[model samples]
Target: MEQTYIKKILKTRVYEVAKKTPLDYATNLSRRFNNHIWIKREDLQPVFSFKLRGAYNKMANLSEDILAKGVIAASAGNHAQGVALSAAKLKIPATIVMPKTTPEIKVAAVQSWGAEVVLHGTTYDDASKYAQQLVEQQGLSYIHPYDDEDVIAGQGTIGMEILHEHSGKLDAIFVPVGGGGLIAGVATYIKYLRPEVKVIGVEPDDAGCLHAALKAQERVILDQVGIFADGVAVRQVGKLPFEIARTHVDEVLLVNTDEICAAIKDIFEETRTITEPAGALALAGLKQFIARENCNGCHLITIASGANMNFDRLGYVTERTEIGEKREALMAVTIPERLGSFRQFCHAVGQHFITEFNYRYADDEKAYLFVGVRLNDGLEKDRLIAKLRDKEYPVIDMTDNEMAKSHIRHMVGGHTQSLANERLYRFEFPERPGALLHFLTRMGQRWNISLFHYRNHGAAYGRILVGIQVPDEQLNELQNFLENLGYPYWGEANNPAYQLFLN
Candidate 1:
């Protein structure tokens, strides 16, 4: 059978790759899943992903005539590095076309593999179209990222290696889906050798084109893809790989940005390895499935496919980790007509830091405010709900909803006030210090500060507004204290009077 012959080549490739990589068991995940979970350590591949398997296999099998013509590929991640390293090894010049938005880290890593990197267009489709044109004009052999048979066979070798290394008892293999070459190759080999071994594909929820296509029984194109998992945010999966997946893959799961961030942080904390969001998708999917289905007492293997992470992106990953774990509570607080009511509301919130606060009174009636609080670590959502219900406050949890997190956090307030004249204050403090109360208590006048606003908004310090009646001369003493307090202070008393009337 053609499949049998291909498996033979995959067998040889598997032997070679196993000699090159480590089959390190992931103790943290294993303990949590109650299964002997192991990482293929493809991230430890010479090119930082399993992509080298396919690239080298394809190049090694190339005819002398084709080798002389060189090779080209369009990839924004592992495939680029794989092709670069493989072509360099085979002494074949390679040109890689990548999406313009590909991370600098990936681009630099691919270049380091000795391939010429051409950054073009905004998506993989754009670069891939350009690559096709180059194949015709430049007479270069175009290496389909995952569409070709050889590339799939090469990726299959990783599956062969897994069976050999893991005592031949893998319950399932989790693979991250992109162009689908990696999973296709892997799934084909997995099905041929161990038909029952589940091959699950993980995809970004924002770019689950493959899963969408599988459901539709045809190719589907996404109009927009999330760039957070830039490496695997493919708008569509390859036709050939899709065929292989439709037949052999057991399931495909979609993970959102928060889940991917949680997986990335989990790996970093447990193994001290940082992976790109796409690389973490498989683990995120596994965690979701395990939680929803109780996948305990079963062996699972995850391919931490790549690690070419940009240093700057780590901050966003860390910031979203809380959101992923549901440890940050975001809400819009609506306050009614009363003076000590604001003070009572403050007292009502127990054991939480006000991470963000914004306030404005549209009319004389009600003030709309945005409030975010840092939940105590390990607090249960039900307890949080109960705590909020016990108080005379309305708390709607937007932690799990992405639409709410991005847009709602911005538009959470609406105007309910009819009276206008509100005051604004611009206060600047050192990057630190008890800036809020320190400024508030220093005012020395109880002008009934009507509105307040602040966002723990990652600024050098912070900004807030206090709608207290403008005490023209009292500001001098206030300004004196702020200046002596070693921070910049500006009185916004000159704020345009009518700006307040517009709500």
Candidate 2:
């Protein structure tokens, strides 16, 4: 079976539209890790993504009769642009169905390529169903994004090129996986030719479809997936790609959104090019792998998968990169409300850069201060906390606290005594013009909103921290309301940060 892919990959027709991107050595990354780290520049392709290779190859293989009938595809973003450009090059009609929640930048890119864009439901699965229905009704051929043999073979060209460039020197190749097409193709080809080299798949921790499927020994659909790395947020791995990945991929690594953001910063520092979260996934995994294995002086390669980043998202990425890299520590400190207290706290912090400092005088005896200090690493944070403890200053580390990082840091004010039976919850929902209004309407004046904080981070989703007052007897009713709200939410009532500043 591996030999079959080997043969197919050798004959792939991706060259018609796809370029043989260079394998560029990352001198800075290599030096930092003490390993020879190289990046496969799939991001340099004309379409700014490797999806063009597979999309073009699959379209090229279709018969003239079938091509004349046109092709259709469903994608969140990258694949839609790939199919649209491929169809434009081949002078064939193409229709792309994309989720209505797709970023506006991506939707515009698909339209710019002259394809018929059909905005469908909220997720890829919904758009896929609509696209399949169109195939039967409109007499069009459907081009599966990652499930087809031809497409996998096309993506295999990257593996072939990597080997041709590096030969047998590479220790491992890290591939970003959504539905497993890229890793399936690369692993199949590499294992058949040079079985010694490892092929690893990387995924966002919140959207680890391939990792989950490989662990279960069969396909398993995720109940929910995070949208930060929207490009690779698939609920389920493709049937064929999952089978190949299960056999060939040596390991699967999961990286968090913050890690991905740090990787994007790493790439930008080296190349002056910002990558989307999914695009930086392989590098994020590579860093984690190097740390876990204590690998050094080894040759490693990771694919820079795509560069179709939304310009507005860079702010959110920058906000998390410092914490991701362990260069900053967020903390909450309680000090006596005295004239010399502020100076004492600053003296305790020493010469470390103060990135942020927020304090509001609440009580006559004590006050809580939300602060951020530059740190050399995680160990430095611990030492600082120890010093503060010796000085009898109560401190709570907020670096890893999601609520503290996302909302509470920006909101530090006097607590209200009039609000009784208050419960706090953080929610994430699709960001649209009337989305907040719709949510308020759904609440239907059942409970009073005691506290609320929201800021647009220019992401596809909106995050909000809401405090609602509900009696103990209405706990079941609150659960029912959240279930029907159709939005992801987490209770923060027990969070120390909330108790310290808001309660």
Candidate 3:
């Protein structure tokens, strides 16, 4: 099996459309981690992602008759651009079915390649179903994003290039896993040649299909996947890729949204380039592995996967970077509702930089203060909390509190004493134009909105927190309404942060 894939990868003509991306040395990261870090610059590909290699390879291997009938693909963004460009290069008709919620820039990029863009549904799965229908109806050839063998072989060329570029002692190579094609392909070639070199796979914790599959010893579908790293937000690993991964891929590591954000900043500091969350995934894993293993002066590599980032999303990434790096901490501190009490609390927090402070008077005796403190190290947060406690100030660590970080911090003083029967929810609203208005229309003024907080993070989706008043008798109606609304939501009525800062 290894020999067959190795031969196929070596013979693949990915170079017709995909360039051999350079393996770059991250000097800053290398020095900080005490390891020689090499980054595979797949983001520099013409289509700005490694998807071009697989997309083109799949199309190129097609029979002349199939090519004449045109090709079709479904993608949220990156793969769509890859297929569109490949079709243009081959002068064949191409139809790309993309999610309606895909970023505008990506839709334009695909259209720029002369491929017909069909904005079909709200998710990649929906678009894929429509694409399959079109494939059968139009007699068009389907180019899968990551499943087919030809596609995997094309991706395997990256492994071939990596071995050719760095002849030194490479300790490990980290690859980001979506549907597992990249890892499967790279692991196959690397294991076949340099059997000692480890091939690690990285994935976001919320969308770790490959990790879940490996643990189950079979392919398994995830109930839901977080779309923060939309490029790699797959719910299931492809069957072929999972089979390869079960045997070749060394291990899978999971990183959270904040860790992924920190990695994006790290990549920018080194390469002066901002990568999407999924692009920075491998480097994030590499850093975690280095810290866990306490290895020094060893050669490590991570693939910088893609650069098609939404400019609007950078603000959110910047906000989370410090927290992700464990250099910042958030807390809810309670003190006497008097001037001298604040002064005493400030003295307790002496010399520590305050990144944010929010205080609101709930009564004449006590006050709730939401504070963000910059920490020199992760342990400093504990020290600061201890100091505050010694001063008789009640403090709650809000650093890992999702409600505080996402919504409560933004609306700290929105407590209402007169409102009743209000329930809180966090929703992922599609970021398309009029989406909010559409949500309002669906809500239909049936229930009174007690509290609403929305701040655009500039991705394909909006993080929204809403408080709706529903009488006890209308609980079933509210549940039915949310289910019919069709957006991912979580109830936060009993969230500790909500109780501390808002309730």
Candidate 4:
């Protein structure tokens, strides 16, 4: 199977559209990590992603009859662009089925390649189902995003290029895993050639299909996946890719969204390139590996998979980068609600820079303040916590608290004792004009909105925290309303941060 894949990858016709991306050295990263760090610049491809390599390779291998009939694909992201461009280059009429929630920028990009775009369902699964129906109805060839053999081989060419460009003592190669095609292909080729060099797969901690599958020893579906890194938010790994990964892949590492954000900043510092969340997954994992293993003077390579980032999302990324890098600590401090309380707190803070502070009048006895403190290193958090304790100021570490960081930080308003039946919920919906209005309309004026907080992250989705007043008897009705609303939501009534500051 290895030799078969090797031969197929060697003969893959992806160059008809894909570029042989450079395995460029990362000078700044090397200096910081005290190792030779290199980045495979797959983001420089014509489609701004390595997806084109696999998409075009699969399309090119089709028989003339199949090619003449045109092709179809389902993606809300890079794969759609890859197939669109590939179809244009092959002079075939292509149709891409994307989720209705897909951002306008991506929809426009796919259309720019002269492909017919069909906006369907609200998720990749919906789009994929619609694409399958279209394929059956129109006799179009389906260009899968990452599950086919030819597609995997096409991606294998990346590994071939990496080895060809670098002849140094290579330690490990980090590849971002989505549906597993990229890592599957790269791992196969690299392991076959340089058996000693580790092939590590990186995945977002919230969307770790590959990591879960390896641990379970079988392909298992994730009940829910995070959409922050929309590119690799797959719930399940491909069957074939999982099989390849079971043996060929060395290790799989998971990094949180904050870690991924930090990696994006790191890549920009090293190469002046902005990459999508999934694109930075490998580098994030690489950084984690180095910090954990404490290895030095070893050659490490990370794939910069794609650069098709939503410009609006950069603000959110930048905001989280400091926390992700462990250079900032978010703390919840309690002080007496008196004139000199703030001054005393400031004295305790001393030389540490306060990056953020949020306080609202809650009660006369005590005041809860949400604060962000700059840290010189990761170890500073423990020391700062102790320092505040010594000053007799009660502090809670809110850096790793998702609810506090995502919603509470933006909302520090005092709790309302009047609204005793209020229920707190967090929701994520597609970002578009009138989206909030639509939500409100569906909510109907029956229930009183006691509290509401929302901030635009500039991504395809909008996150909102809502507190609605509903008696216990009407709880089921509220559930029914949320279900009919057709958006992802989480009940946060028991959230600790909300209790500490708001409730």
Q: Give one digit per residue, the lDDT tens place, for model 1 in 1-503.
A: 34853554454443343235666788887886677777767777877777788777777777999998989999878788888888777787999998765656778888986889998875567899999999999999888777877778877777777877876576888999988988987888778878888999999988898899989999998875666786786788998888888889999999888889888987776678898787788889887777777777778888888887767667667767876766666664556656776777777676677776666555566555566677765466557556665885665555664434533354434442444444555444422445566666765564556656554432223444445554565666544655665443445545322132223
lDDT of 3 by residue, 1-503 (tens): 77888888988978999999999998999998889999999999998899999889889999999999999999988889999999999999999999888888999999999999999888889999999999989999999988999899999999999999999899899999998888888999999999899999999999999999999999999988998899899999999999899888889999988889999999999999899899999998998899789999999999999999999899889988999999999999988987788888888899999999998779888888999999898789999999899888889998987768878888998367888899999999888878888889998978999888998887778899999999999999999999999899999998878887776
Alpha-carbon runs more than 4 Å astray in model 4: 432-438
Q: Rate the local accuracy (lDDT) of all candidates.
A: 0.72, 0.90, 0.91, 0.92
Each model's TM-score, in the order given? Answer: 0.76, 0.97, 0.98, 0.97
Model 3, which residues run further than 4 Å from truth? none
**Model 1, residue 254: displacement in angstroms?**
0.9
Reference-based lDDT, residue 281, model 4? 91
> What is the alpha-carbon lDDT for the whole of candidate 4?
0.92
Local distance difference test, candidate 3 = 0.91
lDDT score of model 1?
0.72
Between prediction 1 and prediction 3, the one with superior lDDT is 3
Model 1 pairs whose backbones collide: 363-417, 363-418, 363-419, 364-418, 364-419
Worst 10 residues of 2 by lDDT: 454-463
Greater-lDDT candidate between 2 and 4: 4
The number of the candidate with the highest lDDT is: 4
Q: Which residue pairs come into collision in candidate 3? A: none
The full ranking of all candidates by lDDT, starting with the best, is 4, 3, 2, 1
Candidate 4 per-residue C-alpha lDDT over 1-503 given as tens digits, one digit per residue, 9 for 90 to 100: 88999999999999888888898899989999898999999999988999999999999989999999999999998999999999999999999999888988999999999999999877899999999999999999999988999999999999999999997799999999999999989999999999999999999998999999999999999987888998999999999899999999999999998999999999999889999999999999999999999999989999999999989899999989999999999999999999999999999999999999998888789988999999999999999999999989999999998888888988887766666888999998777666788889998887999888887786768888998999899999999999998788899999878887888
